[model samples]
Target: MIRIGKSVIVLVLLLLAARPHVYAQATDVVALTPTDDLLTALRIESSLSVFIDSLHHRTVRDIQVMPFSPVGRAVPNAGYTSEQARANPIWLRFRVQNATNKPIPLFVRVNFWCFESLQLFVTQTPEKTSAQTGSEALIRLLPPRVSRAVSTTAVDSLPGLLAASPVVGWRTPVAARPVHNRHFFFPVTVPAGADYTVYLRTLKVRGAQVVPVSLLRQAAYETWMQRDYLFWGGVLMTLLFVSLMSFFFFITTRDPIYWTYLLCVICLIGFMVINNGFLNQFAPSVQFWLPRQNCYFLFPLLLFYSNLVFVRTFLPLKKTPLRWLHRLSAGVLLAGLFCVLMLVVENWVQLSSPVEMAFLRLFTLFYWLPMPVMAAYVVMSLYRRYYRSAAWLYLVAITPFYILNFGQVVANFGLIPTYRPLVNFDIYAATGLFEVLALTFGLAYRYKLMRDNSDRLLSSQREQERTTFATEVQTLAQKNSLLEERERIARDLHDNVGAQLAFMITSLLHIGRQVEQQPIVNGKIQAEQLRTIVGYARDAIRTLRETIWAIQQERFTLAEFEERLNQYVNRYVQQTNGLDVVVEVEGDSGQPLTSAQVLNLFRIVQEALSNVVQHARATEATVRLQTQPNGTFCLTIQDNGQGLNFSPDDADNGERHYGISNMKRRTEELGASFRIYANAGTVVEARREAEMAN
Candidate 1:
């Protein structure tokens, strides 16, 4: 059946080609007649033939001939002669005939030249021959053997030939009239021997035999042409708008997708302009330079590049077979660019054949093949990645453009002839609109990602800060614990050890008093021992008081501390007999010491005093407290009589008492130095470093 249909179409096309002059018979003819018999005698006979061709691919059918003749001809005495016959007025009559089996209601259109002075008079039937005296003709419709004249009156008349120009005469709407089934006629007159031609063109349908079919087809084609121009113009304008926007966006944003889109739109508009003959109408020079071959090459390259950019942005085909496809597209584009450059250099003018042109267009179809696969990949990837509704929306946005563009391609390649009219529809317009919408959606998606990421980062930062703050609080708590422990230890030592020593001192004094009046042999030795023991007790009490003071707060100045120390030492000296003690104060004694350092100094002094009274039975003891220029305090206790000949072995063998060891330990704990040596006498000295004021 397909083969039969194909063969029938081929035969019809051949038949159409065989009859080129068939359209010439459908024009309206005009004849001129004279009013006077003298001018009629000079009348010459002439005939005119005109040809009309259908622009679209169609065969003209059911030819209608409309002829009109003039009412009167020029008279010699009426300021017109034989020389005016060339410019004389003419009128014509119309006739319709049907050669097919079906009846046809004819619509006769009389179009006359403005300068020919032609006029139309429609009657029921036209007369067969010219009448010498009348201004009317008989018209009739005859079926095979029967013919009848309807009237002999004129419907309208003109004075002279119309000015030499095109003119529109009588036109009738396509109305349903009697189906003649055979033939019909109406007639008018024209100037004798005047040369004139008429043009007859079919309306719309190709090879439509029925009159109604032809008329309806003609009206439809006209309407279609009008709509086609409007739709195509609107699409071209829209493409131009998007192209400008894309260009501007590319300029501002420097995004490759915008540039690719701009180029695509430009190519799309070029294809539209060239295909619709707008390029031929407005820029015919450029049209000569461009043809179907160029369109084919340009369209595919633009499409491929645009797809690549979109895929890179929307789909991110950075790996796998998709990546290979992108590379292949790039290679094809480069080859196309090279071809364009060669064409420019070599001035290659036109495509060799329609097949080559078709091949070039076929490349566009090939270019489109990757898009569906790419879109599917994108959809799958985005779905797996959970990109909300963006993936789906993007696919929807892209689908229409894909379909329209590919549909246009199919139409251009004649894959579907019915879709040929849609070839000029702005697929690019639809495509561009969709692309812009898709880009907007993509930006929204990016914005969502950015916002989510920002939120996460802020949450993480808050968590980290909370951890840091908690760590700091823990460290502070630990430090407070250590400080409280130190205070407790200081308080315990002051209360316990200090009370015991005070009680012992009281007991010793009471014993001394009791034994004073007896005058026993060892009474003096006993008194001295009691006194030394009492001195040791006093020193212990002073040391405990200083420790409590150290723990309470900070210490007083060096001058005040020294004065208090001197008074204590003097009281000790007065109580003990057989001892001379001298106290000396030097330098600026007003320098301050820390509470801990003061406590260490007091203990060291107490240890030295005990040592003096217990071990040194010498006659004189000197105590000195001095402040030095180097921000330090020095305390010294020296004995002038009977310096001990202490051996290194004796000190090492534990001969040296714990008083000296304790003093050294206390001084060292306070960040001071303690030394024992003979400096003109046995000297015990402790030195403490002080903080310098800023």
Candidate 2:
């Protein structure tokens, strides 16, 4: 028993899937009154009266006489498509009772205008219970029944092809519609206090999307159109703004992401404009017809393709499932383009029929169905990383459209039944506007971050260049200072070696002449002259050694300077005939001095000692080193000899006080001071103060 019940349930489920989903299929008479200004056919019982000519090639007269199943399915109120979707055309017929004091003029409107033909047929007079007579209206009364054997060839021999009211719809140009709108409106006037029947004829009428029909007063129809246009127009403006803004950014930064984003929006706008029926109403017929006829899927296919490119460029899709989605979208794009090429060639070759074209257009949705499922993974993956705030905003902006798009895809594939509210393109339009506008803000933020990073890199490069320039300047300055110091050392060598050698050679020559003339002088005379020459040679060697040492070092500490000074003075005292010198250092501050400072300071001490021996005629000399406050070094050389007087006039005298001037000049070279004054003995003091620290 259980197995039988399960099998029966399975059979029932298969039957339901195989059947056409339709609802509210019965048509009834609608009563009209003066108080009713506007109404939609969706909610009323009788407004849904429609008949399908299963064989699409039928005349208006044949349809009027054929039995219209009073049970007719309305567009939105009905579930979805029925057995008569693309292959057959439908005729809509409804009865309305005019209960007003005057004849009621009603407009029967079909809200889409893509049909190849639309004709209006109505009874000329209101029927009273089974019969009524009035010869006033333009149309004749329709018969209750049509003969199946009525010959179409016999009817063509008559006066008109229609054999009914004048045809109007796309057969009449869009500009010549009764209301001249995006929708088809046919006027129906019912005489007061009577009933009349109306019919709207359509051929090749199905659209890519569902179409809505409404019945309203003339004023109400115009007002309703204004509101609809206003809403869609605002959406257009928002999308246009996004396109312009992204294009401007692409120009400024030349980022391919922005360029792709602009392309996506442009394609979206084009697709939506055509899909919304705005282009059908406003565009020139020849210019507009070719695209829908040939490359109908171009804009929408390009839209999804560009969107995939934008996602790949702006986000890291590598090593993920979304990468496959990108590839699939690419395939769809190429297929759609190829399909367009084939359509363009249809003028020469009958590659496919209109029915096949419709099927192919809808079948492309199979490629896009997996996109929403994959998008869920991408959104959740991106959400976990709050750092990618830009991509997150992009996903947030498109989330609504993704939901609607999922519904659209499922409906197109017949996996779910379509309803006007769920499957209409108008909802897509609103969400599309929201997506582009929000993505614009995200693009701006992303650009700002890129620009800031660029600026920081540029600033760091400039700072590095400045530092390099400063280092180069410092190196050049040091080279110049070294060259100057080498030149000073050469001059010192000249003074010690060249001048002393010349004087020694002259004195030796005179001693040799004296020895030669005397011939029998004591051994003491020859020996004394030889010893004098040796003393001069030793002094030259000592001076040469000090210059060499100072030149080798770049810097000298105070302790090293003091120790070297002491060694030199001891050697000098031994060379001088029995001259006694005492060296005393009072301070031991570990101060650093430049090589030039020590060299020049040591030379000043040497000059002062020479004066003590040569000019002061002193037997004993004292060399004292003292550290003054604030990093100053004071060197004093005093002798207990008859004091010598200092005179500026003597300094200028030719070579009279050359040693005095040399000491002063050397002290000045150290950027210090030199003083010569008599205390109980003659004192020569040179003071050097340290420079301020940076």
Backbone clashes, each candidate: 35, 3
> Cα-based RMSD of the predictions, in order?
23.5, 9.1
| lDDT tens readout by residue for model 1, 49-101 | 21222222211111123222221221001111122112222222222222234
Residue-level lDDT of model 2, residues 392-469, one tens digit each, is 565567766765665555555555544444445678887888788778877888889888988998898888889888
Flag clash pairs in model 2. Answer: 25-72, 26-71, 65-146
How many clashes in candidate 2? Answer: 3
lDDT of 1 at 564: 65
- Over 4 Å off, model 1: 1-301, 320-391, 411-417, 424-432, 444-694
- For model 2, the stretches where C-alpha displacement exceeds 4 angstroms are 1-52, 58-86, 91-113, 119-173, 185-202, 205-209, 215-217, 220-230, 285-292, 316-333, 352-394, 421-425, 496-592, 609-613, 616-694
Q: How accurate is candidate 1 locally (lDDT)?
A: 0.46
Top model number, TM-score: 2
Give the CA lDDT, 0 to 100, for residue 146 in model 2: 22
